[model samples]
Target: MSKVLIAYFSASGVTKNLAEKIAKENDYDIFEIVPQEIYTPADLDWTDKNSRSTKEMNDKSFRPPIVESTDVSGYDTVVIGFPVWWYTAPSIINTFIESVDLSGKTINAFCTSGGSGIDKCVNDLAATYPDLNFAKGLRLTGAESSEKIKEWISE
Candidate 1:
Protein backbone atom coordinates (compact mmCIF):
# COMPACT_ATOMS: atom_id res chain seq x y z
CA MET A 1 0.00 0.00 0.00
CA SER A 2 1.22 3.48 -0.77
CA LYS A 3 2.02 5.65 2.21
CA VAL A 4 -0.17 8.73 2.28
CA LEU A 5 -0.01 11.97 4.21
CA ILE A 6 -2.93 14.30 4.84
CA ALA A 7 -1.76 17.74 5.85
CA TYR A 8 -4.14 20.61 6.42
CA PHE A 9 -4.88 23.98 8.02
CA SER A 10 -8.24 24.81 9.53
CA ALA A 11 -9.23 27.81 11.60
CA SER A 12 -12.80 26.86 12.53
CA GLY A 13 -12.45 23.03 12.40
CA VAL A 14 -14.45 22.66 9.20
CA THR A 15 -11.40 21.82 7.09
CA LYS A 16 -9.94 19.83 9.94
CA ASN A 17 -12.94 17.46 9.98
CA LEU A 18 -12.61 16.89 6.26
CA ALA A 19 -8.92 16.18 6.55
CA GLU A 20 -9.48 13.80 9.42
CA LYS A 21 -12.09 11.83 7.50
CA ILE A 22 -9.83 11.39 4.47
CA ALA A 23 -6.93 10.35 6.65
CA LYS A 24 -9.02 7.81 8.47
CA GLU A 25 -10.49 6.34 5.31
CA ASN A 26 -7.12 5.99 3.62
CA ASP A 27 -5.14 5.19 6.73
CA TYR A 28 -2.94 8.16 5.96
CA ASP A 29 -0.83 10.00 8.45
CA ILE A 30 -2.06 13.42 9.49
CA PHE A 31 -0.17 16.67 9.80
CA GLU A 32 -1.62 19.99 10.77
CA ILE A 33 -0.23 23.26 9.45
CA VAL A 34 -0.46 25.32 12.57
CA PRO A 35 0.43 28.95 12.33
CA GLN A 36 2.61 30.66 14.92
CA GLU A 37 -0.12 33.26 15.21
CA ILE A 38 -3.52 31.58 15.18
CA TYR A 39 -6.28 33.24 13.21
CA THR A 40 -9.49 33.79 15.09
CA PRO A 41 -12.87 34.71 13.56
CA ALA A 42 -11.88 38.33 14.05
CA ASP A 43 -8.65 37.80 12.19
CA LEU A 44 -10.47 36.05 9.31
CA ASP A 45 -13.01 38.82 8.76
CA TRP A 46 -12.54 39.46 5.07
CA THR A 47 -15.11 42.23 5.03
CA ASP A 48 -12.75 44.46 6.97
CA LYS A 49 -10.21 45.89 4.56
CA ASN A 50 -7.64 46.06 7.32
CA SER A 51 -8.28 42.60 8.75
CA ARG A 52 -5.14 40.51 9.05
CA SER A 53 -6.35 37.81 6.64
CA THR A 54 -7.56 40.36 4.11
CA LYS A 55 -4.27 42.21 4.26
CA GLU A 56 -2.29 39.00 3.95
CA MET A 57 -4.41 37.84 1.01
CA ASN A 58 -3.94 41.22 -0.69
CA ASP A 59 -0.19 40.77 -0.32
CA LYS A 60 0.51 37.54 -2.11
CA SER A 61 4.04 37.35 -0.80
CA PHE A 62 3.03 37.38 2.82
CA ARG A 63 4.12 34.08 4.34
CA PRO A 64 2.10 32.77 7.25
CA PRO A 65 4.34 31.91 10.18
CA ILE A 66 4.41 28.13 10.58
CA VAL A 67 4.69 26.62 13.99
CA GLU A 68 6.70 23.63 12.74
CA SER A 69 7.72 21.72 9.65
CA THR A 70 7.49 18.01 8.79
CA ASP A 71 9.31 15.75 6.37
CA VAL A 72 7.42 14.25 3.45
CA SER A 73 10.03 11.80 2.26
CA GLY A 74 8.27 8.76 3.68
CA TYR A 75 4.96 9.41 2.01
CA ASP A 76 4.30 8.54 -1.59
CA THR A 77 1.09 10.56 -1.75
CA VAL A 78 0.48 13.87 -0.03
CA VAL A 79 -2.96 15.42 0.17
CA ILE A 80 -2.51 19.08 0.92
CA GLY A 81 -5.58 20.70 2.43
CA PHE A 82 -6.56 24.22 3.38
CA PRO A 83 -9.41 26.69 3.38
CA VAL A 84 -9.68 28.90 0.33
CA TRP A 85 -8.74 32.47 1.15
CA TRP A 86 -9.59 35.37 -1.12
CA TYR A 87 -10.20 33.02 -4.05
CA THR A 88 -6.80 31.40 -3.59
CA ALA A 89 -5.35 29.05 -1.07
CA PRO A 90 -3.79 30.39 2.09
CA SER A 91 -0.22 31.69 1.94
CA ILE A 92 0.61 29.13 4.60
CA ILE A 93 0.13 26.55 1.82
CA ASN A 94 3.00 28.11 -0.06
CA THR A 95 5.03 27.90 3.12
CA PHE A 96 4.13 24.21 3.52
CA ILE A 97 5.01 23.21 -0.03
CA GLU A 98 8.29 25.08 0.11
CA SER A 99 9.14 23.42 3.39
CA VAL A 100 8.73 19.96 1.89
CA ASP A 101 10.86 19.04 -1.07
CA LEU A 102 8.20 17.08 -2.97
CA SER A 103 10.47 16.35 -5.90
CA GLY A 104 8.91 13.11 -7.14
CA LYS A 105 5.94 12.69 -4.84
CA THR A 106 2.32 12.44 -5.93
CA ILE A 107 0.61 15.50 -4.49
CA ASN A 108 -3.18 15.67 -4.33
CA ALA A 109 -4.66 18.92 -3.12
CA PHE A 110 -7.92 19.24 -1.19
CA CYS A 111 -9.62 22.32 0.14
CA THR A 112 -12.69 23.69 1.91
CA SER A 113 -14.12 27.03 0.98
CA GLY A 114 -17.16 29.19 1.51
CA GLY A 115 -18.53 29.37 -2.02
CA SER A 116 -15.44 29.44 -4.23
CA GLY A 117 -13.83 26.29 -5.58
CA ILE A 118 -10.26 24.98 -5.44
CA ASP A 119 -9.20 25.71 -9.01
CA LYS A 120 -7.02 28.68 -8.12
CA CYS A 121 -5.34 26.75 -5.35
CA VAL A 122 -4.70 23.71 -7.54
CA ASN A 123 -3.17 25.88 -10.24
CA ASP A 124 -0.95 27.69 -7.79
CA LEU A 125 0.20 24.42 -6.25
CA ALA A 126 0.95 22.92 -9.65
CA ALA A 127 3.04 25.93 -10.55
CA THR A 128 4.82 25.89 -7.21
CA TYR A 129 5.74 22.21 -7.37
CA PRO A 130 6.27 21.59 -11.02
CA ASP A 131 8.15 18.38 -10.43
CA LEU A 132 5.45 16.67 -8.37
CA ASN A 133 2.45 14.97 -9.91
CA PHE A 134 -0.96 16.31 -8.86
CA ALA A 135 -3.20 13.30 -9.23
CA LYS A 136 -6.61 14.55 -8.12
CA GLY A 137 -8.14 17.05 -5.73
CA LEU A 138 -11.29 17.53 -3.69
CA ARG A 139 -13.05 20.68 -2.58
CA LEU A 140 -15.85 20.87 -0.07
CA THR A 141 -17.86 23.72 1.30
CA GLY A 142 -16.48 24.55 4.74
CA ALA A 143 -19.89 24.26 6.43
CA GLU A 144 -19.92 20.45 6.84
CA SER A 145 -17.34 18.74 4.69
CA SER A 146 -16.57 15.40 6.30
CA GLU A 147 -19.03 13.33 4.27
CA LYS A 148 -17.84 14.87 1.06
CA ILE A 149 -14.26 14.09 1.94
CA LYS A 150 -15.13 10.48 2.75
CA GLU A 151 -16.88 10.04 -0.59
CA TRP A 152 -13.88 11.43 -2.40
CA ILE A 153 -11.54 9.16 -0.50
CA SER A 154 -13.61 6.11 -1.37
CA GLU A 155 -13.48 6.97 -5.03
Candidate 2:
Protein backbone atom coordinates (compact mmCIF):
# COMPACT_ATOMS: atom_id res chain seq x y z
CA MET A 1 0.00 0.00 0.00
CA SER A 2 1.13 3.54 -0.71
CA LYS A 3 1.68 5.98 2.10
CA VAL A 4 -0.21 8.63 0.18
CA LEU A 5 -3.80 8.50 -1.09
CA ILE A 6 -5.44 10.68 -3.70
CA ALA A 7 -9.18 10.97 -3.11
CA TYR A 8 -11.44 13.20 -5.17
CA PHE A 9 -14.96 14.12 -6.27
CA SER A 10 -15.38 14.97 -9.91
CA ALA A 11 -18.70 16.03 -11.35
CA SER A 12 -17.38 16.85 -14.84
CA GLY A 13 -14.31 14.53 -15.13
CA VAL A 14 -11.82 17.42 -15.01
CA THR A 15 -10.89 16.88 -11.42
CA LYS A 16 -10.90 13.13 -11.89
CA ASN A 17 -8.39 13.38 -14.69
CA LEU A 18 -6.07 15.50 -12.61
CA ALA A 19 -6.40 13.19 -9.63
CA GLU A 20 -5.59 10.16 -11.76
CA LYS A 21 -2.52 11.88 -13.16
CA ILE A 22 -1.32 12.81 -9.71
CA ALA A 23 -1.84 9.31 -8.37
CA LYS A 24 -0.20 7.61 -11.33
CA GLU A 25 2.78 9.95 -11.33
CA ASN A 26 3.36 9.38 -7.63
CA ASP A 27 2.23 5.74 -7.46
CA TYR A 28 -0.38 6.56 -4.85
CA ASP A 29 -3.70 4.87 -4.22
CA ILE A 30 -6.81 6.60 -5.53
CA PHE A 31 -10.43 6.69 -4.41
CA GLU A 32 -13.41 8.34 -6.00
CA ILE A 33 -15.86 10.18 -3.80
CA VAL A 34 -18.98 9.25 -5.67
CA PRO A 35 -22.31 10.84 -4.96
CA GLN A 36 -25.26 8.54 -4.31
CA GLU A 37 -27.20 10.41 -6.99
CA ILE A 38 -25.02 11.21 -9.97
CA TYR A 39 -25.34 14.77 -11.17
CA THR A 40 -26.82 15.51 -14.54
CA PRO A 41 -26.00 18.62 -16.54
CA ALA A 42 -29.31 20.17 -15.57
CA ASP A 43 -28.65 19.55 -11.91
CA LEU A 44 -25.29 21.28 -12.34
CA ASP A 45 -26.59 24.42 -14.00
CA TRP A 46 -25.54 27.30 -11.78
CA THR A 47 -27.79 29.76 -13.55
CA ASP A 48 -30.84 27.77 -12.48
CA LYS A 49 -31.56 28.89 -8.94
CA ASN A 50 -33.51 25.74 -8.25
CA SER A 51 -30.91 23.37 -9.62
CA ARG A 52 -29.66 20.64 -7.28
CA SER A 53 -26.17 22.09 -7.11
CA THR A 54 -27.38 25.64 -6.48
CA LYS A 55 -29.74 24.54 -3.73
CA GLU A 56 -27.04 22.44 -2.09
CA MET A 57 -24.50 25.24 -2.23
CA ASN A 58 -27.00 27.75 -0.90
CA ASP A 59 -27.17 25.72 2.26
CA LYS A 60 -23.69 25.58 3.68
CA SER A 61 -24.66 22.95 6.23
CA PHE A 62 -26.03 20.59 3.63
CA ARG A 63 -24.02 17.45 3.00
CA PRO A 64 -24.88 15.61 -0.18
CA PRO A 65 -24.76 11.87 0.40
CA ILE A 66 -21.79 9.84 -0.85
CA VAL A 67 -22.03 6.41 -2.48
CA GLU A 68 -19.60 4.68 -0.17
CA SER A 69 -17.22 5.10 2.75
CA THR A 70 -13.42 5.25 2.50
CA ASP A 71 -10.63 3.97 4.69
CA VAL A 72 -7.86 6.52 5.36
CA SER A 73 -6.20 4.59 8.14
CA GLY A 74 -3.32 3.22 6.12
CA TYR A 75 -2.31 6.49 4.50
CA ASP A 76 -0.22 9.12 6.19
CA THR A 77 -1.24 11.74 3.66
CA VAL A 78 -4.47 12.29 1.73
CA VAL A 79 -4.79 14.63 -1.26
CA ILE A 80 -8.38 15.78 -1.76
CA GLY A 81 -9.48 17.09 -5.14
CA PHE A 82 -12.74 18.66 -6.20
CA PRO A 83 -14.16 21.33 -8.45
CA VAL A 84 -14.90 24.81 -7.17
CA TRP A 85 -18.61 25.18 -6.52
CA TRP A 86 -19.78 28.60 -5.36
CA TYR A 87 -16.09 29.43 -4.95
CA THR A 88 -15.49 26.52 -2.60
CA ALA A 89 -15.62 22.78 -2.43
CA PRO A 90 -18.92 21.05 -3.14
CA SER A 91 -20.85 19.96 -0.06
CA ILE A 92 -20.21 16.32 -0.86
CA ILE A 93 -16.66 17.07 0.30
CA ASN A 94 -18.08 17.85 3.72
CA THR A 95 -19.85 14.50 3.72
CA PHE A 96 -16.67 12.71 2.68
CA ILE A 97 -14.57 14.44 5.33
CA GLU A 98 -17.08 13.61 8.04
CA SER A 99 -17.46 10.03 6.91
CA VAL A 100 -13.77 9.23 7.22
CA ASP A 101 -11.36 9.31 10.12
CA LEU A 102 -8.56 11.52 8.84
CA SER A 103 -7.04 12.28 12.20
CA GLY A 104 -3.25 12.73 12.15
CA LYS A 105 -3.17 12.57 8.35
CA THR A 106 -1.62 15.35 6.30
CA ILE A 107 -4.56 16.67 4.29
CA ASN A 108 -3.73 18.52 1.08
CA ALA A 109 -6.35 20.05 -1.19
CA PHE A 110 -6.47 20.57 -4.94
CA CYS A 111 -9.25 21.83 -7.15
CA THR A 112 -10.08 22.30 -10.84
CA SER A 113 -11.76 25.59 -11.69
CA GLY A 114 -12.10 27.90 -14.60
CA GLY A 115 -11.57 31.07 -12.57
CA SER A 116 -11.12 30.30 -8.93
CA GLY A 117 -8.14 29.76 -6.64
CA ILE A 118 -7.71 26.92 -4.17
CA ASP A 119 -6.92 29.11 -1.18
CA LYS A 120 -10.49 29.94 -0.18
CA CYS A 121 -11.62 26.34 -0.49
CA VAL A 122 -8.69 25.07 1.52
CA ASN A 123 -9.15 27.76 4.13
CA ASP A 124 -12.83 26.90 4.49
CA LEU A 125 -12.04 23.26 5.00
CA ALA A 126 -9.26 23.95 7.47
CA ALA A 127 -11.54 26.23 9.46
CA THR A 128 -14.35 23.70 9.53
CA TYR A 129 -12.13 20.77 10.45
CA PRO A 130 -9.59 22.41 12.70
CA ASP A 131 -8.41 19.08 14.00
CA LEU A 132 -7.14 17.88 10.66
CA ASN A 133 -3.69 18.85 9.42
CA PHE A 134 -4.27 20.64 6.15
CA ALA A 135 -0.91 21.27 4.49
CA LYS A 136 -1.12 22.75 0.97
CA GLY A 137 -3.63 23.52 -1.73
CA LEU A 138 -3.15 23.82 -5.50
CA ARG A 139 -5.45 24.97 -8.26
CA LEU A 140 -4.92 22.68 -11.24
CA THR A 141 -5.93 23.24 -14.82
CA GLY A 142 -5.42 19.65 -16.08
CA ALA A 143 -2.31 20.74 -17.98
CA GLU A 144 0.26 20.40 -15.25
CA SER A 145 3.50 18.59 -15.89
CA SER A 146 4.70 15.68 -13.77
CA GLU A 147 7.43 17.83 -12.29
CA LYS A 148 4.89 20.40 -11.12
CA ILE A 149 2.91 17.73 -9.32
CA LYS A 150 6.07 16.33 -7.77
CA GLU A 151 7.08 19.76 -6.58
CA TRP A 152 3.67 20.49 -5.07
CA ILE A 153 3.44 17.15 -3.29
CA SER A 154 6.97 17.43 -1.99
CA GLU A 155 6.12 20.78 -0.42
Candidate 3:
Protein backbone atom coordinates (compact mmCIF):
# COMPACT_ATOMS: atom_id res chain seq x y z
CA MET A 1 0.00 0.00 0.00
CA SER A 2 1.10 3.55 -0.62
CA LYS A 3 2.18 5.59 2.38
CA VAL A 4 0.33 8.71 1.27
CA LEU A 5 -3.26 9.32 0.22
CA ILE A 6 -4.62 12.38 -1.52
CA ALA A 7 -8.31 12.90 -0.79
CA TYR A 8 -10.35 15.81 -2.03
CA PHE A 9 -13.78 17.40 -2.35
CA SER A 10 -14.47 19.62 -5.32
CA ALA A 11 -17.68 21.55 -5.92
CA SER A 12 -16.24 22.35 -9.32
CA GLY A 13 -13.36 20.53 -10.97
CA VAL A 14 -10.52 22.75 -9.78
CA THR A 15 -9.66 20.97 -6.56
CA LYS A 16 -10.18 17.56 -8.11
CA ASN A 17 -7.71 18.38 -10.88
CA LEU A 18 -5.09 19.52 -8.39
CA ALA A 19 -5.58 16.45 -6.21
CA GLU A 20 -5.20 14.10 -9.18
CA LYS A 21 -2.02 15.84 -10.26
CA ILE A 22 -0.54 15.58 -6.80
CA ALA A 23 -1.46 11.93 -6.44
CA LYS A 24 -0.12 11.03 -9.87
CA GLU A 25 3.12 12.96 -9.40
CA ASN A 26 3.81 11.52 -5.97
CA ASP A 27 2.46 8.03 -6.65
CA TYR A 28 0.06 8.37 -3.80
CA ASP A 29 -3.39 6.82 -3.43
CA ILE A 30 -6.35 9.07 -4.13
CA PHE A 31 -9.91 9.33 -2.86
CA GLU A 32 -12.79 11.62 -3.72
CA ILE A 33 -14.92 12.99 -0.93
CA VAL A 34 -18.25 12.87 -2.66
CA PRO A 35 -21.36 14.35 -1.10
CA GLN A 36 -24.47 12.18 -1.05
CA GLU A 37 -26.26 14.77 -3.16
CA ILE A 38 -24.13 16.46 -5.79
CA TYR A 39 -24.23 20.24 -5.89
CA THR A 40 -25.79 21.98 -8.86
CA PRO A 41 -24.85 25.50 -10.04
CA ALA A 42 -27.88 26.99 -8.29
CA ASP A 43 -26.93 25.21 -5.09
CA LEU A 44 -23.44 26.69 -5.38
CA ASP A 45 -24.48 30.30 -5.90
CA TRP A 46 -23.07 32.27 -2.99
CA THR A 47 -25.03 35.39 -3.86
CA ASP A 48 -28.27 33.65 -3.06
CA LYS A 49 -28.76 33.46 0.71
CA ASN A 50 -31.04 30.47 0.22
CA SER A 51 -28.52 28.55 -1.85
CA ARG A 52 -27.62 25.11 -0.53
CA SER A 53 -23.98 26.06 -0.07
CA THR A 54 -24.80 29.24 1.78
CA LYS A 55 -27.12 27.44 4.16
CA GLU A 56 -24.59 24.69 4.86
CA MET A 57 -21.83 27.24 5.45
CA ASN A 58 -24.05 29.32 7.68
CA ASP A 59 -24.53 26.32 9.91
CA LYS A 60 -21.01 25.39 10.96
CA SER A 61 -22.17 22.14 12.51
CA PHE A 62 -23.85 20.80 9.42
CA ARG A 63 -22.09 17.83 7.83
CA PRO A 64 -23.63 17.12 4.47
CA PRO A 65 -23.84 13.37 4.06
CA ILE A 66 -21.09 11.85 2.00
CA VAL A 67 -21.85 9.35 -0.74
CA GLU A 68 -19.54 6.78 0.78
CA SER A 69 -16.78 6.40 3.34
CA THR A 70 -13.07 6.02 2.59
CA ASP A 71 -10.77 3.49 4.17
CA VAL A 72 -7.60 5.13 5.50
CA SER A 73 -6.15 2.14 7.34
CA GLY A 74 -3.41 1.41 4.82
CA TYR A 75 -2.06 4.97 4.73
CA ASP A 76 0.18 6.80 7.13
CA THR A 77 -0.20 10.23 5.55
CA VAL A 78 -3.40 11.73 4.21
CA VAL A 79 -3.48 14.83 2.06
CA ILE A 80 -6.80 16.59 2.15
CA GLY A 81 -7.74 18.99 -0.63
CA PHE A 82 -10.78 21.15 -1.21
CA PRO A 83 -12.00 24.43 -2.66
CA VAL A 84 -12.19 27.30 -0.20
CA TRP A 85 -15.72 28.40 0.47
CA TRP A 86 -16.32 31.63 2.37
CA TYR A 87 -12.62 31.88 3.19
CA THR A 88 -12.47 28.40 4.75
CA ALA A 89 -13.16 24.74 4.03
CA PRO A 90 -16.73 23.82 3.35
CA SER A 91 -18.57 22.05 6.19
CA ILE A 92 -18.54 18.80 4.20
CA ILE A 93 -14.83 18.56 5.02
CA ASN A 94 -15.85 18.21 8.62
CA THR A 95 -18.03 15.31 7.62
CA PHE A 96 -15.21 13.60 5.75
CA ILE A 97 -12.72 14.05 8.59
CA GLU A 98 -15.10 12.62 11.11
CA SER A 99 -15.98 9.69 8.89
CA VAL A 100 -12.50 8.25 8.84
CA ASP A 101 -10.21 6.91 11.51
CA LEU A 102 -7.26 9.24 11.05
CA SER A 103 -6.21 9.17 14.69
CA GLY A 104 -2.43 9.01 14.28
CA LYS A 105 -2.09 9.79 10.61
CA THR A 106 -0.16 12.79 9.33
CA ILE A 107 -2.79 15.10 7.91
CA ASN A 108 -1.71 17.68 5.37
CA ALA A 109 -4.07 20.11 3.65
CA PHE A 110 -4.05 21.81 0.26
CA CYS A 111 -6.75 23.99 -1.19
CA THR A 112 -7.83 25.65 -4.44
CA SER A 113 -9.37 29.06 -4.24
CA GLY A 114 -9.85 32.26 -6.21
CA GLY A 115 -7.96 34.25 -3.55
CA SER A 116 -8.29 32.76 -0.07
CA GLY A 117 -5.20 31.52 1.72
CA ILE A 118 -5.13 27.99 3.21
CA ASP A 119 -4.26 28.95 6.77
CA LYS A 120 -7.81 29.34 8.06
CA CYS A 121 -8.85 25.93 6.77
CA VAL A 122 -5.75 24.22 8.10
CA ASN A 123 -6.04 25.96 11.45
CA ASP A 124 -9.67 24.97 11.72
CA LEU A 125 -8.92 21.33 10.96
CA ALA A 126 -6.03 21.25 13.42
CA ALA A 127 -8.24 22.69 16.11
CA THR A 128 -11.07 20.36 15.30
CA TYR A 129 -8.89 17.25 15.21
CA PRO A 130 -6.20 18.03 17.73
CA ASP A 131 -5.22 14.41 18.15
CA LEU A 132 -4.28 13.91 14.52
CA ASN A 133 -0.80 14.85 13.36
CA PHE A 134 -1.71 17.78 11.15
CA ALA A 135 1.42 18.69 9.26
CA LYS A 136 2.03 20.94 6.19
CA GLY A 137 -0.50 22.72 3.98
CA LEU A 138 -0.41 24.55 0.64
CA ARG A 139 -2.65 26.71 -1.52
CA LEU A 140 -2.58 25.58 -5.13
CA THR A 141 -3.85 27.02 -8.41
CA GLY A 142 -3.65 23.80 -10.53
CA ALA A 143 -0.82 25.30 -12.62
CA GLU A 144 1.88 24.53 -10.07
CA SER A 145 4.91 22.59 -11.22
CA SER A 146 5.48 19.05 -9.96
CA GLU A 147 8.66 20.24 -8.23
CA LYS A 148 6.73 22.77 -6.18
CA ILE A 149 4.26 20.09 -5.12
CA LYS A 150 7.05 17.64 -4.28
CA GLU A 151 8.76 20.30 -2.19
CA TRP A 152 5.55 21.13 -0.32
CA ILE A 153 4.78 17.48 0.44
CA SER A 154 8.33 16.79 1.53
CA GLU A 155 8.24 19.72 3.91
Tell how far residue 139 is off in model 1, in angstroms.
1.0
List, residue by residue over 104-129, the lDDT tens digit for candidate 1: 87777888876787777888778766
Poorest stretch of ten by lDDT in candidate 2: 146-155
Clash pairs, candidate 3, are none
Candidate 2 local lDDT, 1-155, one digit each (tens): 33989999999999998899899988899999999999999999999999999999999999999989788999988899999999999999999999999999889899999999999999999999999999889999988898998678767
Clashing pairs in 2: none
**Candidate 2, number of clashes:** 0
The number of clashing residue pairs in each candidate reads 0, 0, 0
The digit string of per-residue lDDT tens for model 3 on 16-123 reads 988988889878889999999999999999999999999999998899999998899988888899999988889999999999999888888999988999998899
RMSD of each: 2.6, 1.3, 1.4
Ranking by TM-score: 2, 3, 1
> Which runs of model 3 end up more than 4 angstroms from their true locations?
none
Against the unseen true structure, what C-alpha lDDT does each candidate score? 0.81, 0.93, 0.90
